[model samples]
Structure formats: structure tokens, C-alpha cells
Target: MTENKNNRTITWIVGGILILLLAGVSVLLISEKKVNKELTQEFELEKEDLENQYTTFARQYDELKLTVSNDSLSSLLEQEQLKTQRLLEELRTVKSSNAREIRRLRNELATLRKVMISYINQIDSLNRLTAQQKEIIADVTQKYNAASATINNLSQEKKALNQKVTLAAQLDATAIEVTPLNKRNKRTKRTKNIVQLKIDFVISKNITAQTGEKTLYVRITKPDNDVLTKNDADVFAYENRNLRYSIKKYIEYTGEEQPVTVYWDVEEFLYAGTYRIDIFTDGNLIGSQNFSLN
Candidate 1:
């Protein structure tokens, strides 16, 4: 009986140890599962924040691009777009808590950003087009004014010139740019066929002269003091001594924001030198601008 009792005690001790070991393993597994769940939850929240921020950023960028008047700011925009794309890619690779559903959400978010980028580019292009159109209109107006002054007999009346000078010059003209259509937007160069410039002025509504034709001339001055002249007598109406224009344009004065533009061919071989342009018409110098070619 004593031997049997000792054998029974040993068996009980072994069974207790086995039970304790199993309990510890169960606790460890439960703790591990809880930690994994929390980590996945945190990651999901972070991903959501990133996605929301990226969307907001893209929207803001588009709004800002619409207002972009300076070409220098374009570089900053492209950089922001690249960063968003990289973040979207990273979001895609992130391991979500639920391997299926969360991953799908991240992928969807990335795709949305990609689509947004495309839309942003399209908006940028549209804005560029609109800007170009305004420039063309201004150019036409300036040229028309110049041609009419030379051709119209009514402009010879001194009182008429004074009346126009007083009112038309007071109305403010918003400056519009005439950048080349094919420009890459990364740099500024005179080598392109069309070199765009901006014209800003004010037109006064009250004038002494009866509404008729007003002549405006835009003469580009090269570094050699030689004025850029044109062969078209209509666009190349005389300003100072020569037929002055690098790009000749004509416009009729309805008197509003007269943003004008003219084109220069690459065949001109613009050397490294300082170039300037002056606009003349309506018995008032409307505007002037200058830039360098290097």
C-alpha cells in the first residue's frame, strides 16, 4: 500500500506540471493575438489619415493651379504630385489587419489619388489654353488698333486723340501671359517660335472723343537698338523710325482688360542679349516689358 501511495503521488505531480505548462502556452498565444490586433488597427487608422490628407492636398493643388499666374510655381506643384504618388504607392504595400478588406481599401485609395493626378493635369492644361486664348485676343486688339490709327482718317482730329487718352487709359487692363504653346514649363528660353509676354494697363470710361478706332503699336526692341519689324504692313504700323515688331498683332479697342500677345519665330536666332518691348497707341504709352536671352 505504501509503494502504491508513493507511485500515486508522483503521477499527480507530473499531471499538475503538464497542466501548468499548457496554461502558460494558452496565455502566451492570447497575448500575441491581442497585440497583433492592436497593431493592425493602428496601421489602418494611419492609412486612413494618409489617404484623407492626400485627397485634400490634391484638391487644394488644383484650386491653386487655377490661380497660378507665375510659371515658377509650377515646379512646386509637380513636386507635390510626385510626393503624393509615392505615398499612395507605399499605402498600397502596407499590410492591413484584415489581409483582404483593409488591403483592398488601401489599394482603392491609391487608385483614387492616381485618378486625381490625371484630373489635375487636365485642369492645368485647360487653364493654359484659356490663358493662351486671352493673350491671342489682346494681341489681335493691339494690332488692330495700330493698323486703324495709320489707316483711319478720323484719328487725325487732335480733340479725338485727347478724349481717348483721358478715358481709355483709365480702365485697368489685367495682365495676361502669352507663353509658347509647346513650352515644357520647366524653363524659360527664347529659342521657341512663340515668345509670350504680358500687357497690363487701365482704360478710362470717360473720354472726350466720339467712339471710333484707336491705334496701338507694340514694338519689340532688340539688343542692337534695332526695333523688331514685320513685313505685314497692317500689323507692322510705324511707331518710331522703322516697322517695329518681333511679333505683330492687331486689336480693336472696345476698352477692357486688353491682354495681348505676339509670336516670334525661332528662325530669328535670338542671341544672348537684353530685349525689351514697348506698346504705343491711343496717344498714350500703354505698357512696356523687358527680358534677357541667354
Candidate 2:
């Protein structure tokens, strides 16, 4: 009976040891699951931070394009942007806790940052050179303008001296007289007795004027400001348009004081008012006079 009791005690001790072993294994499994959850959470956080950094780097690349102007540099920047986008797509597809892919992307980001810094330095150098060239061009242009102005001033002075010499060489007329002749070829003051008009003038001598056959035109303006012309087609250039003349005469000008006479026949009705006469030669109004009749 004592031996039977000892055997029962040994059996109970073996059962208790088995139960304790199972409990220990259960506790170990639960603790292992908790540790695995913590490691996954840490990896997930690290992945999220890496993604955020990639996004920030992309934004910086976009901003950098705005600061540059060179076409070649801009193209390079576009290529870099494409590379960054491709890497970001790859990062998105990779699992958050994939340590290998994450580390590769991080290294790429570092390399891209170095490349961006190099491009920035190159762009700055190009901009500074362009500024220096602009300054040099401005200085050269200022000197050219100053020289051009001096040449223009000298040309104007030369033109002015030539004009003074031309003016001193112009001809003149003096001792002008007009006579309204009657039907019997005698001067008359009555409008009804006038049949024609005679104009007499003396050309003053000018040694500077050329000796040649000269044509002179006489413009007769009536009281109503009407010019009496033999024909409507009889016109000469005055300012910029044709002007009607009453009569024209030719003379052999010998640079001496010589008398000249020209006649105009009356074909239109006359009025008892003041009349004006102007004589032109070589595009110059050398003489002007006025007369009145009853």
C-alpha cells in the first residue's frame, strides 16, 4: 500500500510539470507575437518618414526649375524630375517594411541632392557672366551714341553755312510800277476805260547771280481775291501746288540793272476796288504791288 501511494505521487508530479511546460510555451508565443508587432510598427514608421522625405525632395526639384533660364540646364532638370518621379513610383509599390528597397531609394535621394547642388552652382555662374556682358555692352553703346551726336552737330553747322551763302546770291527787283491803260493805250483810273494793264520793273544788279535767259510770272489778284488767268491750265508751282498766273515773260538777264515790261489783256469784267500784283522768278517772289481804280 505504501508503494502504491508513492506511485500516485510521482504521477501527479509528472502531470503538474507537463501543465507548467505548456503554460510557459503559451506565454512565450504571446510575448513573441507582441515583439513582432513592435518591429512591424517601427518599420512602418521608418517607411512613412522616408516617403515624406522623397516628397519634399520632389517639391524642391520643382522649385529649382523656376530659378534657371538656360535651355540646356532646364532640360537637365526635367530629366532629373523624371528620374525622381520614377523612383517615387517604385517606392510606392514596395512594401513599407522592405528594408532593401528603402535603403536603395534613400541612397538615390542623396545622389540626386548632390547633382542638384552642382546644377545650381553652374546656373549661378552663367547668370553672373551674362550680367557682366550686359554691362560691357551698355558702356560701349553709350560711347557710340556720344560720337554719333557730335557728328550730327557738325553736319548741321555745315548745312547752316551753305544756306547763308545761297541766300546772299539771290536776285532782287526794284522801281516797280503798274499802269491800267485805256483803249487808246493811255493810263486811266476808271474801271470802264481800262482795256489792258502794263507792268514795269527794274531788276537790280547782283554779281553773284548767273547770267542767263530767265522766265518771270505775274499773278494778278482782283479785289475779290480772284486771280485773272488767260487759261485754266496756265499754272506754275508755288509752294507745293500749282498757282494760276495772269502773264509770263522771258528776258536776257545780264546781271545789270535793266528795265522790263509785261502786259495782260482784260477779258473779264472789272470792279472798282483795290488789286494786287505779284512777280515770281526762279521760285522767288521778287516783287509785289497794289493799285486802286474808281
| Leading candidate by TM-score | 2
Query: Distance from true position, residue 235, model 1, in Å?
Result: 52
Please give, for residues 88-113, the per-residue lDDT of candidate 1 as tens digits.
66655666555564566556566766
lDDT string, candidate 2, 190-275, tens digits:
88888988989888898878789998898999999999998999888888888999998999999888899989898788999899
- After superposition, candidate 1 runs with Cα above 4 Å error: 50-99, 153-294
In model 2, how large is the Cα lDDT of residue 137? 92
Clashing pairs in 2: none
Per candidate, the number of residue pairs that clash is 29, 0
- Best-fitting candidate, scored by lDDT: 2
Error of 1 at 180 (Å): 86
RMSD of each: 31.8, 5.7
Q: Each candidate's TM vs. the true structure?
A: 0.37, 0.66
